[model samples]
Structure formats: C-alpha cells, structure tokens
Target: MIENNNLVERQYEAKNNDLAEEQHEIKKNNFVVDTEERENAIEPILGSELEGLDPSNYPLITPSIELTIKNRFSSWKIAKYYLKEYGRQKGFATKRYRVEFHRNRTVKKRTLTCEKAGKYKPNKTKPIGQQRNKGSKRTDCKCHVNLSSSEHTHYVHITFIYPEHNHTINADNKRFTTAFKHFDKSIMAEIEHAVVYGYCDIHMIRNLLQLKFSDQLFLMQDLSNAIQKIKCDKKVNRSDASHLLKFLLNQQKKEPTIFVQPLINVDSNRLCSIFWMTANQILLWSHYFDVVLHDNISRTNKYNFPLSLFILVDSEGKSRLGAQAFLNNETQESYKWVLQQTLDATSSEPNVFITDMDPAMNAACKNIYENTYYLYCIWHLLQNLPKRLKSKLALIEKYPNTYEYLHNTLYPTQQSWACVFVNRIFTVGMQSTQCIESINALIYKEVSSSLSMINVVEAIDSRMQKEALKCKFYNMEI
Candidate 1:
C-alpha cells in the first residue's frame, strides 16, 4: 500500500524490487523519494504535519526513523517532544508564577526556590562566564543611600556686615520713652539677630544706614518706621524675639579648652593668633580690635576698637587661624600672662612671635621667652618705615645701596649683617607691620558681628575655616 501523509503530495514506494529498490523518508520534516524512475527531495511546510490536526497550527519536529510493523515511530519519543513544545508555549504563564512566588517568599523559602530552580544540569552547549556586576536599584546596594555634595565641599566662607550708623541703635534711657517700646526693641533686636544669624531684614536699619542692611527684605517700611511696623508683622513675635536676640548675642559661649601662659607676648604690632591642627583658633585667648567704637557704653565720644577678631582659614586652605585687632595700645601684661598660659597649655608652644618692631611687643616677647625666636613681621615693618621716612617704601628699590643692604640683611639667620639690620632695624621707614592690618580688616568685615568680646571670639573661629580655603586656592594658582 502507498500512503501520502505530508502537506506536499508524495507517493511512498514500499516495494517493487524488480524495477528498482525505492525508499521514502517522512521523519526529517522533509520528503525524500528514491523510486523506480527517479530520486527526488521536497521540504515539507514548516509545522504542517501534526498527528492531531488543528486548523490554526502545525507540528514542528524531526527524528531519524525506521517504520515499525504498525507504521509509526515509538510513543516515548512523541511524548518527550510534546513535553518540550508544551513548556515553550506556556513560558509567559510560568514566568508570571515564578515572579509572584519570589515576591511572596520568605528568606528561607527564597533560598530553597533559588537552589531548586538552578539545579538543572544545563546542556554542555550552555555558556559559562562571570556574572555581570549588578546595578544598585535591582540588587538594593547601599551605594546610592544618602549621596550628598556637602560631603565633598570644603568649608564655606560666610560673612555678615553690620550697619555702622543706625539712629535707632542708641536709646535715651532717661527720656519719656514715648515711641512704641516694642517697635524700638524689635528693631534693635533684629539688628542684633542679623549679626548672630549672619543675616538681617529690618526696614529701619536699612534706611538709617543709607545702605541695605537686610534692605526691603524686612517687614518694616523704613528704618525709622521699623519700630512701629515690627509690632504688626506676624513673623516677629514678642516672646520669641527676646529669646532669639539673647541667644545670638551669647554666640560661642561654650566651654573652651583652657590654656595657661607663663610667658605670653600680648603686645604685637599685629595679632598673636595661633593655628591649631585639631582644635579651633581660640580668639577669646587673644583680644580683638576693629574700625569703630561700641554704642553699648553711654559715653558717645570714647574711641574703642570693636576688637572684632576673626579666626578663619587663610587663602592657603590649611586650618583656620585667629586674627588680631587693628593697631591699639600695646596689649596688657595681664593679657600677655593669660595668652602665654593658653599657648603653653596647647600641644606645643608657638615659639616664634611675628610682629612689627613696636617697643612694647619687642619688650613683651623678650621678657616672655628666653629661647623662643621673634621674627619682625615683614609687612608691618614695611608699612611703618615709609611713614617715618615720609616717602614711599618703593623708593628703596630705586635707591640700590641702602635698599639692597636692607633687603639682604632681612635673612632667617643671625650670622650675617643683612640679618642684623633686617632683623633689628634703626629707621621707622624700614619697619613694616602690614599683615596685621589685613588680618584686622578681615576680622571686622568677615568675622566680627558686634563689639561683644564673647561674640568676637566665636566669629574668629568661624571665619578662619573660610579664609584657609581661600589661601589654599590662591597658593595652588601660584
């Protein structure tokens, strides 16, 4: 009997050996005929020959075959092929179920499932290589947690300048006090608050200064009217205003690491600020001086250096150093004693005192330490010399003989005469105390908020960090 089972019409020849030995193949998913007259090959339609016929689908499978007595392949081969094809068709459903299981599973359950799923002995053809590094989102790694730019940012230099001439500042205690007491107090308190918080927003302070002291940012209409307006402004509450002012005024009232000095040098043409690697520059250990007189005292005429000392990092980016007040009466002996005690108390004594050739400072350092070295502050000496000689300091460059002699003498060691004149000069024009003036200006502008001695010390510490960053960048450029 001849049979035609494929989508392509083909006749299978089972016998007829006298004419020619003939064979036909149906198991290669293709039809092959070697019949009495010819050998021909035909590829069958993909998935077209199915045992269970479906109008919409076909079977795609192949096997090496020899027809059995019943004219069929083994049932075991058919079953195995069906199982593989069925698993492939339901992949989406199986994947959905697996994801649900993983989500609901406990640690123990997940471990068991992961182990079981991975247990298959993969085909030798399966690839093997290192697994790719997992991304943080999928694997829940800690690398992304709390990432902030602040960690990398060096210290910032923040400065607040107070309005120098505000009329509302002074109060006539003996007068009627007719103006709204709350308004006056509020204005004053706001000014004090800006100094502490490093910001301001009072209207009257702005107008009175003729410059913006927190400017229109405040609720008040003008510096004079700020007294009346603060009462109506909801932001300025009476209870909180008093407390806030008090808190800011008492800035940096923390317990300081104590330093006791046996031989202290208080009288410097500039400041005597120490640079500590670990601790902050303790400006309280040194007195500060500034451009203006304090209004806190009743005497309106007395001239006093605000002593707004600042401790800030220099432009070099090292730790902050305490800045000194501007020129004033040489520092007091009691102050000297205290400073010496403080320096001695630190990790190591700051032995070299840098300052201009002011008699008081020179005498103070000489008396304080026998072995400690004192270098004449180059800047201070340069500044004072020109004033004494009544001509510009640059003239030294123009006049080579005295200028070269003076410049060469200013050496680090005492072995040469150049070291002697530069070290111990005879004229006022050659003596310069330049560094302290710059340091003093910084203290007033960037560090000191008010004339309060306590606040001055705090400002010094705060300002040093910023100044150091500046110094570091400047040096890097150089």
Candidate 2:
C-alpha cells in the first residue's frame, strides 16, 4: 500500500510539472492547446469513413489470440506455419502467437503428463510397503509423429484475413483548423504582417497583408504552400526567401543573453533579482544575447527601467543567451510597452539586473515590486564615473595606494588612498554599472539587426523562447 501511494504521488507530481504555466512577460510567447483541453472543449475526433459501420452503431470488434495448439503437424519445418505465440522481447523475451491453420480432417487429441526423473525413498533407507514408488511414472498419449515430407502438403493448411475494425480517437485537426482559419481576418493580416515581416520581407508584405486568413497560423503543409507561392516574388530570391520570413531572427545568432536593470527604490530598490545576481556569478554569465527594434525609447516607466531584460541558458551549458536594449543614446523609447513586454517575457521576480545608478530605474523598482533588492554592477559604475571626473581616474590609477585605500579599506571614508577615484576625484556611490556596456555588446551578438522590424521580433521571440525554457526549468522565471 505504501509503495502504491508513493507511485501515485510521483504520477501526480509529474502531472503538475507538465502543467508548467505559460506566464509570459509576453516573451511574445504563445500557447498550444493540449489534448484534454481540446476534448473537453466539445470536439473529439472519431474517424469512421464507411457509413453505418461507426463504433457507436456497431460493436467494437476485438481480435483474440490463442496460443494453444493441439493435435497438430509434427514437421518442425511446418511448425512455423501452424501458429505463433508472441511473448515480449529483450527484457521479457515475450512472444505472441497467431493461429495460422484450420484443417477439416479429423486429428488425434493428446494430453501432456509429467513423469518423475528421480526415484525417492519412502522412509529412512527403505521404501514403504506397496507405496514404493507412487507417482513416479504416469502414462499419457501426448505424442508427436513426424509425417514424411511427401505427405506434408496433404496435412498443412493456412488462412489469412483482412484486418478490420481497430480504431482510436484523436484530436480533429480538420475541425480545429476550420475554426482557426476562420478567425478575424484583420488580426490575421496583422499577424501575417508581423510573421512575414519577421520571417520574410516588405515586398511580399503588401500582398500578404491583403490575405483573408492573415490572422491564423496555417497548418504545416499550408504554410509550405504559402512559401512556395512566393516563388514568383521578383525582389526575393528563392535562397533569400527564408530570410524574408526570418524577421525577428538574427541569422547569425547561436542564442542570446539579455542584461537586466530592475526598478529600485529605498522602499523596494534592492530589486530581488539584482542583489541575487552577485559578483560570484560572472562565469554563470558571459556573451549570449542581443539587441534590436530600431526605435528611440524614452526612459519613462516609474517602476521599471527601459529595456529591462533577462537571460537564458540552453541545455548545453556551453551555449548561453544575452539580451540588450536599443537606445538612441540616453532616451529610451516606448518604454511602458517595452517594460510590460519584458515583464511578460521574464519573471515578475528577476535574477540579475545590470544598470547604471539611475534614479528613474530605482523609482520604478520600488513601484512594481516592493520587496526585491537591486545590485548595481561594479562595471557600469566605472564607465559612468569618467563622465563626472576629467583626470581623476588617471590620478587614481597613478596613485594605486590612494585608490586601494579609498575603494577597499575606506569606502565611505572621506580621506583614503582610493579617494582620488571614489571620494577625491569623482562623485557617485560604491555600487557601479561597469560591465553594462560590454554586456550589451555581447547580447547584440545573437539579436538580428539587419532584418526588418517584423523579422527582428520573430527571431528575438524564437531565441528568447528557447532560452526561457531553460530559465523556467531552473525556476528563473523573471
């Protein structure tokens, strides 16, 4: 009973794991209907082509297999023709049998009886009177008599029948496709524009925009046909056809890793993800992400920073993904939409956030999540410091003792060796955003830049998904 209970618990756990939520910071993530969902939603596919022979109208025919063969031909060669009993294979070595012959001629029937191979004593050294060797031997007619090869043809017969009436129900693609295809045409057109602009190009864009079924993701075969139709495109070569469709995809990207900068505030600024991404995790992060969407986004979200990004790790630890943002210098564009999308793509709680000591981002964090901690990257701070002090960094580097004194021994201390860089030379706290620029360059490695707006989104979406799967498994949902 305990064993059974454990098995049931394990099964339940597996079921729950399979139900992993599709909580998207929209990763632009999509959903796929499961079997149970489809079945419960009113349509179940039961294929019955021949009328009147449907399973509901007619009893389901189940074929039976029998392994017992009696009074049969003795020719071992013909034994192969009589029947077969299948028991399983490999581990079980199981074999199953099917009846192969039915002869009309009268045949002898026999029973199998066992005979003892060894003798046994009744008592100590002597056999009991009259019961000397009881059950030692028994007579049975179970026998095999080989027929001459010449008579073989006269004794053996075999029959074969058409396999009929085996069936199972599956999801009805036809019905589902019909419903899917008939979705709002306007949405379809938009998706096509997005999908095509993502996967293909602008030339075919106009024509695809006019398509009625633009809102639906076509069946695999139908999608193939649609691409084939593009053979006539004058501006797009057959080779480049795939590129036209690969809108959001960076052709060169192995994958991408996105850097993040969560909102931080005195109330909530430590931004859980940032503080969690400690200095020890440098190896955990490297170059594996990208940047796209050529638009000037303004840094405006009160609770989140512009291009608040995340990271992904593939099954093979060797390959990583990094994400970066597009900026026309300091002003970020469409920030609210971007932040929302990033949130959809990443976890509500983030893992790492590498950003400048920007107050706007700090305020955003305090607004969205009131309990997270944000760690300022030491690297980003180094880069930003040069803007404040002219020759202070040079002096700090020249006066190594002062630099060490200020940065290491006396951070907040006004008088220290590192004072040239920290206190004497520049202004800004100990926390930094040093590697933020380098990290951004690394992420761009995988994000598509040459592609159109639509294609870039698609590629980013695809890459992000593969990466996000890894994150989900690791519980790095943010």
Candidate 3:
C-alpha cells in the first residue's frame, strides 16, 4: 500500500510540473505580443507628417514606466508592497511565489506572482470522471515580479517583471479575493479580550467586523483563525513545574497577604516542592486551626505532581481549603517540609490530625505534632482490611493464635484507627478523610492533567471564589 501511494504521488507531481512548463510557454508568447504592441505604439512619427503640425498642439508622448524597468524600489519589501497596492487598484491579486534566504536567514531573493498563476487540479476525494459543477479561480496566469539583492549592495533590484494578464481586471472584484482580506489589529485585540473574558460568540463578532469594515473584505475563517491564534499564544512555553512557580510569585505580587514558598533541589536546580496560601485561605486557617486533614491527589496536572490539599472544616460542617502544595516526590523530607510550612502558616499545630495509610505522611505527622492526636482515616482502613485478611484466613485456621498475632501487631496504633478512642476528641463528628476526598472530586472537575500549570492555578482560584460566594449567599458560618 505504501508503494502504491508513493507511485500515485509521483504521478501527480509529474502532471503538475508539465502544466507549469506549458504555462511558462504561454507567458513567453504573451510577453512577446505585449512587447510588439508597445513597439508599434511608439513607432517614430514621420518627419514629413510633423513638418506642418505645431508641436504645442500635440501632447508629449513620454515612455511608460508604470510596470517596466523605470519602476525601481529601495528594498524588496517596498517593491512587494508597491505591487500589492497596484494590484488592488487594478482589481487583481498577488501572492508570494518563492523566496530564498541567505546563510544568516536574511532574505536574498523573492518572487511575487499573480494569485491565479496556477492551474487547478481536481481533488482526489471526488469520484473518478466526475464533472465539476463550478469553475475554479486558478487560470495559470503568469504575471509576476522578481526581486533580488547582493551582499555588496544594500538596495533590492527588480530583475524581471511580466505585467500582462490573460484575464480581465476589475477593481470591484478585489474584495472577493483572499489576498486583499485582512483584519485590523485593534479589532483583533477587542475580539481576544472579549473571548478571554467569556464573551465568545464567533458569529456576532463576524457580523460586527463586517459592519465595521464595510469597504473592505471580511471572512469567517479569517476571524476564526485570529481567535485561534490568540488562544495558542496564551499556552505556556516553559515546563509546567517552572510556570507553576512563576504563577505563584505573580500571585504573591498581586496580593501581598498571600504566602508562597518553593523548595529547590541544590544539585538539579529544579523545583522540588511548592506551598501557597491565599489571603482568604490564611484567614480560614486562623479561624478553624484546631483540626487539620491533608492528603495527596495525583494526576491533577500534566507533570503528575501530587497536589497536596490541607482542608479545614467550618462551623457549618463544610470543608474549606487552608492551603495547597505540589510535591516532586512523596518522601518523608518533602512531607515534613510541607507540614512545617502549614505549621508556620497557622502559628500552631492542630489539636487533631487525620490522614491516609501512607507511612511517610504518617511518620511526618507524628514527628511534627508529637503531642497532638494523630488518627488514621477509618474509610481507608476499612477499604484495605479485606485485602489484608483475604489471604490470612488459612494462617488463622492453621494456628489459632494467628488472629492474636495480627491483633498484637495492630494494638500499638489502636488509638489511630479505633473509633471509640477517637470519639473522645472534639472533631465536629468527623473521623475520616472523606471530606478531603470529596474536595478532591471537586478539584478534579475544575482541573485536569491536560491543563497548563497557569490555567490549572486559575481554575482552582475560580472554583474557590465560587465556593466562597455560595457560602456568603447562604449565610453559612465560617
């Protein structure tokens, strides 16, 4: 199949090459006819016919230089611009045919051809031998200008020009050509601002543009392309981890009350972890700093860095974000660094802490809050119990004290897992990480692995603002 496809492509290219050669022949003939007409028009007037006529009564016949050797420009760019304007005035269109660049990427030569300088080849998607319903604009016209420059010279010179065309030129028809259509930068800026701020109605924008540029041409595709370019330009070019740090820094600038700290690896100089808390988040922590529940969510961004969220329960029994962090790895040291940040932010350790079964996080919690109560999430413990006991049934039967051994193994941490022991603490009826897990679900809806780090930050901020508004509307006690 590949070989057959290659053969078909080669055949198509060969046919196009043949058509180009035939068009060149036609252009050569037209040039010859044009030259002869100019020669005949400028034929020397007979000396006898001019003998009796008064020279003042006849108009002076100077040479025509509009599209000839007399038309010279200071640079190739100026020459191209002149040709474009000339075409617009004469009701025609021009396009770039080819260009050559110097070793340093400077323009060495350029050619501008008529827009209809190529023959149309039917697309292969149509069935073979199908008749066309309409005609194509391509007429193989060979009108063009050649521009070249040399290293020794600073000016661009016109090397050749063929100003004759086989088709008629109409200035009114210029508006219909793609080459003459363009959107103003101011108009595009307005469209981008509107779309970015959530006013994205393409049809309405098109109508406005048409009304504004009544004398010029406007196409729907051009407007669409402009909007798409605006979107593409907003995408971050740096690594997500790097951009994440920059975004936090900027946010700190905008809101001086916000706190942002990043840990960098000394060897690789890459971001190891970052912790940030907004002004509102800090206020929330100040009000409800008694119980802290933190857990890591993975795959929330393209880099797969775990998003660590510290959640606090309000008086209304609602989960609120105290702060957030992104970690490079799940290590004891990383967790300790984050916990220390949270400690500094709140100015004191929580009376009660709850987390999942991760040993690193558990160890970090115990070391940081040595005097505070540290409890394991009951939901996580229940989910892992069946897996741990499914294979231990035979051992329990073989040795009756196998159950006693398991009990002894788990006895030391009974306070962390047993509900009866945890009921003594003032937890607002909360004993698990279910609240944080539910908050994770809401985060997933606002952010995803495909989003850029900057966009991810913006989405998270927007979600928080909405939640805050909802709380205010219902008069929920914070």
Candidate 4:
C-alpha cells in the first residue's frame, strides 16, 4: 500500500512539473512579442529625428529665420507638410493651422497665409431658446504664417510667422481646407473653352460642369468667381459704342458709301441713333429699289434698339438687304432720322413702300418721301381683326349687314394685300414683309440676345457672306 501511494505522488509531481514548463514557455513567447512591439514603436521616432536633424533639410517654424528666395517656389503641399510636421513636434494637431488668404488672378502677386486657429464665438447675442450660444472665446489669436512669391527670384518665401496658438487643436475634424478649394486643371480648361465659345453665363456653365463631371460638387459662387478670373485673364470686356464706331470706321474705309450717323444723346453724349449701308448695298438698292421695298423693325438685339431693316426684291425675285438702321426710340423723330439716312445712302427712293402699321413709320415716310407710294402690311392690319370681331360675334350673327360693313371697312379694297388687285407694274409677286421677317429669324438663330452691338454687326456680316456663297454656288452650277 505504501509503494502504490508513493508511485501516485511521483506521477502527480511529474504532471505538475510538465504544467510549469508549459507556462514558462508561454511566458517566454509573450516577452518576445512585447519587446518587438516596443522596438517597433520607438523606431519611427528615432528614424524621424535622425533623418530630420538638419534644420535646412525641412521648413523651419522659428519666426527669427529670415525669408529667403529658396522659399519662393514652395507650394501649398510643401507648406502644409511643413505645418503638419511642425505641429506634430509641438504636440498639436496639424489642422489647427487654417489657410486664411489665397491670392487669385485679380492680384498681381501670388500669396498664401494660414491662421493659427479657426474662428470662435461666445454667447454674445441674445439667446434664441433654452440653450445659449456657446463656443471657445479665444477670438483674437494672432498667430499666423504668411508665404509670398519673390518677384525677383520667382521663389516662394515665408514672409511672416506667428506660431503661438491659444485654443486646443481638434484632430478629429478631417474636413478639406479652404486653400485647396479649387477646380482641377481639366475643369478649368473646359471652363475656358466654354467661355471662349460664348457659353459664358454662370448658370449655363454650372449646368455644363454638372453634366461633364457629375461626381464632383461645384458651388455657383465659386464657378462665378472662377469665370471672372478667366475673363480678367482673357481681357474679355463688353463692347461699347466706341468699339462699334471703330468697326464702322474700318468698314467705311473699305466702302466709301458706308454711311454711319450717330445721334448723340445730349445728356450723356452717348450714341442714340446709328444708320449704315455699304457701297455695294447702295448699288443694289439703286437697281432694285423701284419694284418693292419692305421695311420692318426687329427687337431681338440686346440693346433693345429698334433695328430697322430695308429689303428690296432683286431681278431673280430674291430678297436682298438694302440698308440697316438702329434707332433709340420708335418716335417720329428717330424714324425720320433713320429714313433720311437711308435715302441719303441709296440716292434713290422706292416706288412702293410696304411696312407694318407703325404710326411713327407712316408719319416719317409721309414727311420724308412725299412722292413714294406707301402701302401698309395687311398682316399687321389683320392681326387686330380677330379681337375686334370676337367681342361683336353675336352682333355679326344678328346682322349680316354689320359683318359685311366691318369686313369692307377693315379690308377697304384688295389694293393692300390681294394679288388680283395688285399693280402688275410694281408687284414682283411680293405682297407681305415675309422677306425681312425671314432675315430676322435667320439673324436670331446665329446671334443670341446677350450679344453686344459689335457681335450683332459681325453676325449680320457673317449672314451676308453665307448668302453670297450660296449665290456663287448657284451661279457655278448654272
């Protein structure tokens, strides 16, 4: 019995020894892991210190260091990296330095500045509810860093530094900084193309950008500012009356009879009336002015001026532009000036004048061209017939004689619109002012309402050239 008990005790001791050895092995493995972790944590710090030991190797945070040309070429990325490293060394978050000023194209020089801390406020105003406004009261902290490009060296230099900060930095806020709020290069290129091609409106450009880059977010104000910058850079300003006058003068040099008369506003000394006709136009009018002359006003331009176009029928029965005038008002005085200018340019008067029922135009023609036969556009007279009859439809139904009287009074005779009663001598199968209306439609298609006076003139010139090309092609085929 004693031998068995001794054997059991020996077996228990051996099992206990085996368990102790296993625990010792586990503890040794744990110690190795902990030592490795400690070394790894210290390695980064040691490596950074040794690598950055030289002050010249990285940007200096000290304010005593004088700015040099070496800093002229420094970019925002470099400045940000420097700030982050300097902040890490000072035991503060990097984002505490907020970019405050960035020079756009409006300024002649390139500059960037970063404030030590963001804005802070207190419950200075009246409370709106149960809760009062609360925030850090450190509002006047003056720590900042200013960087500017050296004009002589073209290098970026640290012009100023005030690194001391009052508020604690928040590392959790990872929002993008305002300094980096800029369109990418590709986006700017697209904006330039759009602006150059006349899609310069801010709203239109924004929609275009949205379509092109749906993944990106663009604020309207930012896009406007960017467009303004581009305009400044390209020097694309609105064309004024002086520009128009200069262009006309150039045209007059080419065509001696290109008459331009500017009625100056006595109050502002600005152009109020302008009339022009090229020498070729004058020759064409002299040959074709007798058959039928169609005069109409188009109000599609940006200046809201009454654009008076005088058209004539050519030998081929095609509509040809004779003269154009821009009048400030539809008054008899402005119309007289425009008509007198047209007669003076062409040196001939049309036998038959067809025009809308504008009282001012009628009065002007009667006073200016006494011998010219005046004919009103029947379309204009008929436009009010429906409205006049609509209110008296029941009266017309009750009295057939009343309807006949109204129709006779309105039409009077077919001398105005009817082809059967037309004068075969003067009529080239033309009655209405459809020729001028079609010209206006074509002009409106190529020229926008926002175009300047110079652009309007250019668009008209382009249209005339296209017409000439079409004529040339027809002749070639003949």
> After best superposition, candidate 3 residue 438: deviation in angstroms?
1.9
Please list the C-alpha lDDT of all candidates, in the order they appear.
0.32, 0.33, 0.73, 0.63
Candidate 4 or 1, higher TM-score:
4
How would you encode candidate 1's per-residue C-alpha lDDT over 1-478 as one tens digit per residue? 2343642233223334423532332422232223211311222111224545532232432343221111211122232233233322322100110211223341111000101122233344534565443332122111100100111121111111111221121222111122112233434565555433433323224444435332212322223244323333434332332332333333323233422111214574332322121233444223211111101111111123323222222233222344233212335453344334434544233334444444554565566644544456555456655644455555644566555535654432232123454445322222233434555555555322323332333344345544544455455546
Rank candidates by TM-score, best first: 3, 4, 1, 2
Model 3, poorest ten-residue lDDT window? 56-65
TM-score list, all predictions? 0.30, 0.26, 0.51, 0.48
Candidate 4 ranges beyond 4 A from true positions: 1-235, 295-299, 391-421
Q: Is candidate 2 or candidate 4 better by lDDT?
A: 4
Candidate 3: tens digits of C-alpha lDDT, residues 261-306: 8889899998778888999999988888788898999878777788
Please provide, for model 4 over 140-163, each residue's C-alpha lDDT reduced to its tens digit, 9 standing for 90 to 100. Answer: 555555655422222234556666
Candidate 3 differs from the real structure by a C-alpha RMSD in angstroms, to one decimal, of 22.1
Q: Please state the error at residue 207 of candidate 4 in Å.
A: 38
> Taking the tens digit of each residue's C-alpha lDDT, what string does model 2 give over 248-295?
233213223322233323684342222112111222343221211111
Clashing residue pairs in candidate 3 (N, C-alpha, C atoms within 3 angstroms) = 91-171
Between prediction 1 and prediction 3, the one with superior lDDT is: 3
Best by lDDT: 3
How do these models rank on lDDT, best leading? 3, 4, 2, 1
Q: Report the candidate with higher lDDT, 1 versus 4.
A: 4
